[model samples]
Structure formats: structure tokens, C-alpha cells
Target chain A: MTGRLGFWLAHLFVLAYCGVLLAGFVVQFGADELPCPLCILQRQAMILVMCGPLYIIGRARRGDVTLADYTMGYGMSIVAAVVGAGVAARQILLHIVPPDPGYGSAVLGLHLYTWSFITFCVVLVFCGVSLIFGRELVPRGVRFGWASKVVCGLFLVIVAANLVAVFFELGFHWFLPPDPTRYETFHGLPLLGAAAMSGGAVG
Target chain B: MAILIFAVLLLAGWLTVRGSRRATVLVVWTVALCAVLAVFNHHMAAKLSLNF
Candidate 1:
């Protein structure tokens, strides 16, 4: 996964994953301005995924083309990708077996023949592929970057927990109202600046 | 729009510097980002028009 094809393919997949979720919001909610709890969760996951390549620019800027840089970022990328994939899977399942709404009755709209559901599944699959490569791009012998893993691992676990709690609340109808206040906390964590650089390995 | 241009420039410059496997991915991502932004703006414009 260290060649041109792999790099482009990885980005392509992640980008596509982002696009699908963006579309899902439209298809599921019609022209409404508000997003449900789960919908917001999905959008946050995508923004996280986008941080990967955005960070690449940061790393490349510092000329830190070492194995350690790449290794360090691997864990964060995988976790973000996994979270995205999970959200997508849940949405698709909801479409297939939309029981009693569990809690949130979902934003009622035209089914659109499961297009939103299917797109979610596709994005999740893409995240899975991104994770597979991200988690292992660095060699096993390169133990120098292990601390990055531990630190970011802790960071992701926290984010992952938040993601789960938010989604679970959504599932159980324990959501707050659609307010911009909530969206910024989850969506606008400044993933594009220094953090992205530190998160990603060089190239 | 300005921020997005800066992002793309930074990404493209990064890919150019890396000069290897990283270039394609970064370039593609840059392209994808641009496309996504375009789509988002288009959707926003359409919605604004309908609302007005």
C-alpha cells in the first residue's frame, strides 16, 4: 500500500465515503434544514475521515518523511474510519428493518428505494478498507512510533465513546434538539490545522 | 472559497513535494475535495433559491 495506486485509491475511497454521507442527509431528510441526532453523528464521522488527507499536507510541509510519522497517524485514521463505517452500517440496517423507531422516528421522507441506506453501507465499506491499510502501513519492526499509537489510541477511544453514546441516545430517543450549538462541538474541532499534521505520518 | 483554495494549494504542494506514492492520493483527494465543495455550494445555492 506504499505506491501511487494505493495512495490515490485510499483517498478516492475516503472521499467517496464522505460524499455518500453528504448525500444521505439530503435523501433521508428532504429539504429540511435540521439534522437528527444520528444524522449529525454521521456528518461528524465524515469530517473526521477527511482529516486524514488534509493532515497529509501538514506532514508534507514539515518534510517529516519518516516511518514514524506514518505509523503514529495510523491508529487515529483507523478509528475514525471504523466509526464512520459503523454509523453507515447502522443506518443501512435501519433502512432494511426499520422497526418501531426504537426512539427517534427518523425524519420521514420518501424512501428513495434505499439509496441513502445503500450509500451509508458503501461509505462504511470504504472506511473499512481505509482502516485496513492505515492500521498496517508501517512495518512491524518500527517500534519507535509506538507512543504515538498509545496517545492517539487514547484520543480515539474517547472520541469513539462519544460517538457511541451519541448514536445510542439517538437510537433510544434521548436526543437534544437540532441546534447549531451541538453541531460545532462534534463537527468543528479544527481537524485541518496542526492536529492533522501530527496525526498523519509523512506521505 | 478562499479557504478551500488554500487547502487545495497546500494539498497539491504537498503531493508535489512527496513526489511518489503520496502524490496520486493527495491529488485525487484535492480533486475530490474540490468536487465535493462544488456540489455542496450548488446544493446550497439551489436550496437558497427555492427558499427565497
Candidate 2:
């Protein structure tokens, strides 16, 4: 696989990540299900995993793509996916009992975290395959065309949205509840006040 | 705060797409470190019923 091929592949990877993030959002607002702290961590890992491809694309635009760049990109992605998979797995195990109904609603018969685990596994395979085949020298001066910009822009918007969502979910609190029921910032409830009122420890 | 962390990650990503090779490398590593730390912190703070 030539460097140019790898660069385009990176673009596709970015778009795929964007789609996944968007789907998560759809579930959040569309289903009125608030993500728990673990779910948020999984999302964070997804963002971190996507960063690998963004790094590769950025370097390619500078006309300085290298084998090490591909390696590093794939390596970072693998590490992030591993962490994400672990989190998703933990969540799955938490509600694995036969009588337990699982957290939140299931999408296509599998919970969001289950989908996340599957996505991470796919990412691991994708990165590993790309690494094996992507050994050719990358040509310099690869264009950072409009399509790439649009994809990156979409990714930026998604990240920004996540930032806003997290702030609202956490409010002035340093930590979110293990299971968040409402947007603390939106309700204008201070973390201490909410905790005191509920007679529950601040999460 | 998670918001602050995401903001930093967003900034890094923005700087990355602006065509800075140095920023791309830095952001990748920074994000990786942050993801690990965030997960570790969540495990420490949130009560879970896992035994392993």
C-alpha cells in the first residue's frame, strides 16, 4: 500500500468515526437516554482513537508522510481501541445477569456499548491490516482537498458538541454520577445542592 | 472536568488539522494519555460490581 493510499484510507477512517459519534448522539437525544460515566469514557476513547487518523491526514498534507507516521497512527488507534473495548466490556459484564435488563435501551437488539465493543474490534483489525499492507513510500504534496476539510470540519463539530454535552451533563461538578438522569447544568442545580437534596453522595 | 479535557482535545484536533506536523504528533500522544487517565479516574471514582 502506497502512502497516498494510506492517506485516503485515513480519510475514510475519519468519516467512519464521525458516523459512529453521530449515531451515539442520535441515541442520546432521540431515545432520551443519558449516558452514564462509563459510556462517556467509551465515547472519549472513540474520539481518542479517531485522533490517530487525523494525525496521519495532517502529516500527509504537510508533504512529510513517513512509515513511522503510519506506524504511530495505527499504534495510537490500537491502544485507544483496546481501552475502549475494555470499558465497553466492563459495562456489558455489569448487566450480564439473566434477570438484569441491561442499561439504557438496546439498538438493533444490542446495547450501545456492545456496538462500541464491536466497532473497536473492527478498528483493531482495520489498523492491523493497513499496517501490514501500507509499506510503500508516500509521495509528497498530497492535496488537502475540500472533501478532507469537510470531513475534518464535521469531526470538529462533533467534538465541540461533545464538549457542550459533557459540560451540561456535569454542570459545575468535577465528576458525573455513575448513572446520570438529567443535565445538571441545564437544571441549574449545583452539584452539592443536588446531592444534599437527594441525600446521595456526590458522584 | 471532562468538559475541560474535551475542550483541550478539541483544540489539539483543530491545531492538528491546520497542517502542523508537530501539533499532530503532540495531539496524538496527548489524547492517548488523556484517554488512559480519564478511564483510570472513572474506575477509581465510580462504584462498580466487578471482581477480577
Candidate 3:
């Protein structure tokens, strides 16, 4: 594994992980499942994890490839992943006991929070391996490729989506609900079909 | 709180673009760690707080 390949792989993995989170959001909206406060926090963790790759790409574009640079990115990613895992674990513990009824609708036989926990764990392993094999990921002054540009674009879109989602879920400045079940846009409107679905199964 | 979280993220993103590498990493790590602590205890905090 050459340094260039390692760099590209790490960036690609970050993009792929971003895609996974986006897909999860699609499911959440499609299934009319409202995200709980913890779920929203987990999404923020996802954004934080995504930032590592964006930082790497930014540095690579500026021709600032160094061992230290790679280490910083890896460290940021690993820390965010660990934190994300903790958030997921908290959500899992909240619902695991009796009378809680667990999380919302399951995906592929696992709850969304459960999937988040698993993904965060995978991120931990991935970042750990990337750091352990850090020698390979150092930039070699190679020009940023088309794939990197695409991934950067994807990251931007995901960030925008996150911002918009939060704005609609919680109000503009404050007013964040402990457990959000409705979009802020529909706050005062009568219960409609889509609004009904946003209630989610979990109380 | 959600807006504040986003604000912190945007600040981190900006710092990542313009600030020193160590500074950016520190910001990212701090935010993520703080989020974990907050999320883990959000329910309990809400239950106990007079203002949430």
C-alpha cells in the first residue's frame, strides 16, 4: 500500500461513511421516523467524523501533505468515532430494558441506534488501522484526483443537509426539543399525513 | 442547542480551513467529546433541569 493509495483510501472511506449516514436519513424520512434528540446528536457525530476527510482533502489540495497532517486527521476521526459510539451506546441502554419498547423501526432486523453503534465501532477499527499503518497514508504531493473532488462535493452536500435538517427539526436559534417528533415548519399546523408519520413509534 | 451545535461545527470547519493543524484537531476532538457527554446525559439533565 503506497502513501498515495492510503490517502485516497482514507478519503474514500470517509465519503462512503457519509453516504451511509445519508442513506439512513433517507430511510428515517421515508419511513416517517422522527429522530430523537440522541439520534440528532449521533448525526452530529457523523458530521464530526466526516470532517476529518474534508480536512485531509483541504490540506492535500494546498500541497501540505505530511506525517503530522495525516496524524491529525486520523486522531480527529478516531476521537469522533469513539464519542459517537458512546452516544449510540447511551441510546441503546435507554431502550434495552423492559417497558421501554426499544428504538424506532428496525433496519435489516436491527434498530437504527443499534446500527449507529455498529457503524461507530467499525469507524473506530478503521481509524485505528489507518493510524497504525500511517506510513502509507502520508501525501506524496500528487495532484488531487477527480474522485477526491467528488467526495469533497459530497461532503459539502451532506453538511448542508445536516444544517437544513436541524433547522427544520429544532427551531432557528434555540427551542430544541428533548425528543423531537415534528418538523419546526409544521409546528403549528394541523396534523397532516406526513406529520402523522413524524410522530415515530418510540415515545 | 441544535443551532449551537451547528455553530460549533461551522467554527470547527472554518478553523480546519484556516487555523493551524493542532488547533483544528483540538477543536474537533473537544466538540465530539463534549457531544458524547451531553448526549449520554441529555435525558437525565432534562429531567433535572428547570430550563432545557
Among these predictions, the greatest lDDT belongs to 2
Q: What is the lDDT of residue A31 in candidate 1?
A: 54
The C-alpha stretches of model 1 lying farther than 4 A from their native spots are: A24-30, A85-175, A178-203, B1-52
Residue range with the least summed lDDT across 10 consecutive positions in model 3 chain A: A171-180
TM-score for the A chain of candidate 2: 0.88
Provide the overall lDDT of each model, using Cα atoms, as 2-decimal numbers: 0.43, 0.80, 0.72
Worst 10 residues of 3 chain B by lDDT: B43-52
Taking chain A of model 1 alone, its TM-score versus the true chain A equals: 0.44
Candidate 2, residue A12: the lDDT equals 90
Model 1 over residues A1-203: C-alpha lDDT tens digits? 35333334434544555445445545434653344433444455454454453343235434443444453334334554555455444444544654533323344543422343454455456545645675444222322144333333333333343344344333323233433233333344566455777878664
lDDT of 3 by residue, A1-203 (tens): 37777778767776778877787678768987778778877888887887776676667766757888777777777878887887788778767877777768778888889998998888888878878887776767566678777776666666667777777777553546656677876674467655666766443
lDDT of 3: 0.72
Which pairs clash (backbone N, Cα, C closer than 3 Å) in model 3?
none
Docking class of 3: acceptable
* Candidates ranked, most accurate by TM-score first: 2, 3, 1
Question: Which lDDT tens digits does candidate 2 get at residues B1-52?
Answer: 6777787778767876776666455755576556557655567556764455
Q: Candidate 3: deviation at residue A51, Å?
A: 1.6
Number of backbone clashes in candidate 3: 0
Give one digit per residue, the lDDT tens place, for model 3 in B1-52.
7666766775665555442466655766587558546755766466343342
